[model samples]
Target: MRLSQPRVHPLTNDLTPEQAEVLAPLGQGGVIPAGPVLNIFRTLAHAPQALKAFLTWGNYILSKKNDLPAREREIVILRTGFLCRSGYEWTQHVEIGLRCGLTPDEIQMLKAGPDAGWSPADAALVRATDELHADQFISNETWTQLLTHFSQKQAMDVVFTAGQYTQVSMILNTFGVQLDPGQTLDPDLRVG
Candidate 1:
C-alpha cells in the first residue's frame, strides 16, 4: 500500500546457483522448509545473504523457542502490520493469525488498538506493541503490565516478535509486495 506498484519486482526465473544455495536452507531439509516460495521471498532474493540471515532470525521468532504462545505472537505481528499500514503483511498474516487462534472479530479488534476490550494479558501485549511501534520502546508501566501475565522471556519475545514484523512491514510496504494470488486486502485497511 505504500507504493502503488512494485519498486522491486519478485524474481520470476529459476534461481541462480548462489540464489538457490542461499535460499536452499529456506527450502526443504534446511532451517525452515519452503512450500512454493512467496513473492516476498522472491523479492528478497535480490539479496540472498541478507535473506538467509533474515530467515534464521525470523525462524527463531516464529519457532517454539521464542517462548511466547503462537497466538500471542500472531497478535503482536498483526498489530505491527496493521500499525505500519502494510496491506500485504496484514493479508498474509491474517490467515496465519486465524490458524494461531485469533477470530475474525478479534483480528478486526486489533485495528481498534489496545483498549478494544482485550483481556488484561492480551491488552498488555497490545499496549506494548503499540508503544514499540510509536516509541520504538515499551514504557515501564506497560512493561509492568506485561510482566503480570507473561514471563520475562515471553516479554522479550513479545518485543522480538513486534520488532520483527515492524521491519517486515517496512519491507513489504516499501517493496510494494502485493498480495499473493487469491488474497484480498482487508476492507478497513484500504488506502486511497
Candidate 2:
C-alpha cells in the first residue's frame, strides 16, 4: 500500500549497499524494497542475535499451546493492532484473524470496543487486553470471566501474548512502518 505519512526513519537510502542487500530478503519483494520506512527494521536486522531472538519469541506466541484459544489470541492481537495503529501488524493479522474464525463484523467491532455485541468470553479477552495495555492490570470481574473460558495457565499466557503484541504495535507504529507494496490494509479499520 502507498504510505500516507512520511517515514519516521528512512533506512533504505541511508544504508551501505552491502548492508541493505543483506537485510532485503527478509522483507517482501525479494530485495530490500526501496521505501522511506522499513529502513529502521532493516537496520535492526543487522544485529542477527537480537533479530533471531525477537522472531523466535514472536513465533512462540503464535505456535505455542497457550491457555487462550487461537481465536482469543487473534482477538487481542487485532484489538491491539487497531489501538496502536500499526499498519503492518494490522494488515498482516487481519487476514490471519479471519482465517482463525473472527467474522468481519466482529473484527470491525473491535475498533469500537470489546463489548460491542461480543460474547462474554470474547469481550473479556478484549477487556483484558485494554486493561493490561492501559492500566497494566485486569480487574477481578474481567479476570473471573476470562477464567471461565481459559485455564489458569492460559490466563498467564494471555498476559504475555498481549504484552508481546503491544510491544510490536508500539515499535511498528512509532517507527512509521508501512505495509509492503502489494499488501492491503485490514478491512474496515477506523484510524485517527
Candidate 3:
C-alpha cells in the first residue's frame, strides 16, 4: 500500500531465455499455476536466482517443516499482512487462511489485532505477532502465553513465520506488487 502503482512491472520482454528457463520450474506448482504468471512471480522473475532462493525458504515456511500448524501459521501470516497493510499479501493469504481453517470472522478479527475477542490461545498468537511488529521482540508475557499453547519448536516457528511474512509484506508493499487478475484488494488494505 505504500506506492500508488508498481515500481517494477512484471516481466514481459525483459526476460532472457536463460531467465525464462530458470523461472519455468516455478510455474509448475506452488501458489500459481503453469500458465499466465501472476504479477508477483513475473516481477520476481526479473531476478531468477534470487527468486529461486526465495522460493526455497518460502516452501519451507508454507510446508510442514515449520512447526506451527497450518491454522496457527495462517493466524500469524494474516496478522502480519494486516499490520504491514500489504494488500497483495493479505488478499492472497485470505484464501489460504480460510483453507487452513481460519473462519471468516477470525480473519476479520485479525484486522482488529490481538484484542479482537479471540480465545486465549489465538489471542496469544496475535499478541506475539503484535509485539514483534511493534517492538521487534516478543515480550516475556506474550512468550509465556505462547508457551501454554505451543511447543518450543512451534513457538520458534511463530517467530520465523511472523518474520518471514513481515519481510514478504515489505517486498509486496515497497515493490507495489498488485493483486493478480480477478483478485480484489481487502478494503482495509486499500492505500490512498
Candidate 4:
C-alpha cells in the first residue's frame, strides 16, 4: 500500500441532493446500491462527472465490446495490474479472472510474467503487455507473435486492455484506495 490511510475516504451514507443526483444512475430506485460500495466508486463519487465519463470507458473494456475474449482480456488486466503493483486492481480482477476461466495456476503464472510456462498465445499477450509497460511500444517480434493468434482488432484490444488497466493501476495507487472488506491484499503486491 502506498499510504497509511486513504487520501480520499469513501462517501458517507447521507448525501446532499446534488450528490445523490450525481450518484443515482449507479444505484437502483434512486438509493445507493446495497452492500459495501467499492472504495473506488465511493472515492470517485466525489467527482461525479468524471466518474460518469470513466464508467463509459470502463464498461467498454469490461464488456464484450472489446475484441479480446473475457479470459484473454483478464490476462492482460491481471498482468498489467501485477506489473503496476496495484493491489486494488489485482484483487478485484482476480475474481473476475476466475469467472473468465483463468485457473489458479494461470493466475499465479501472471506474477512470473511472460516466460512463466504459458502457451505461445497466452505468453504473447503477456509479452506485449510487458513491452508496452517497459517501452510504451511493442517490439516487432512481439507484434509478429501476436499476429499469429489474434485478428488485428483483437491485437489492438490487447494494447487497449493493458493500457486501460495500467491507467487504472495508476489511479488506485495514487489515490491510495484501500481494499474493501474481506478482500485481502496479495502477499506479493509490495510497494517500494
Following a full C-alpha superposition, what root-mean-square deviation does model 4 have from the true structure?
3.0
lDDT of candidate 3 over 1-192, digit per residue (tens)? 667689988887667886787667765655444566677778888788888787788888999999899999999999999999889998889988887899999999999988999999999999999999999999999999999999989999999999999999988888888788788887788778
**In model 3, where do residues sit more than 4 Å from their true spots?**
30-35
TM-score of each: 0.93, 0.76, 0.93, 0.91
Residues 1-192, candidate 4, lDDT per residue (tens digit)?
Answer: 666578888787877676566666553421123555578887888887778788788878888889999999999999999999899999988988997899999999999989999999999999999999999999999999999999989999998898889888888888899998888889899676
The per-residue C-alpha lDDT of model 4 at residue 46 equals: 81
> What residue pairs clash in candidate 3, if any at all?
none
Model 2 lDDT-worst window of ten: 29-38
Once fitted onto the true fold, the runs of candidate 1 whose alpha carbons sit more than 4 angstroms away are: 25-35
User: What stretches of model 4 exceed 4 Å from their correct place?
Assistant: 25-34
Best by lDDT: 1
User: What does each candidate score in C-alpha RMSD?
Assistant: 2.2, 5.0, 1.6, 3.0
Q: How high a TM-score does candidate 1 get?
A: 0.93
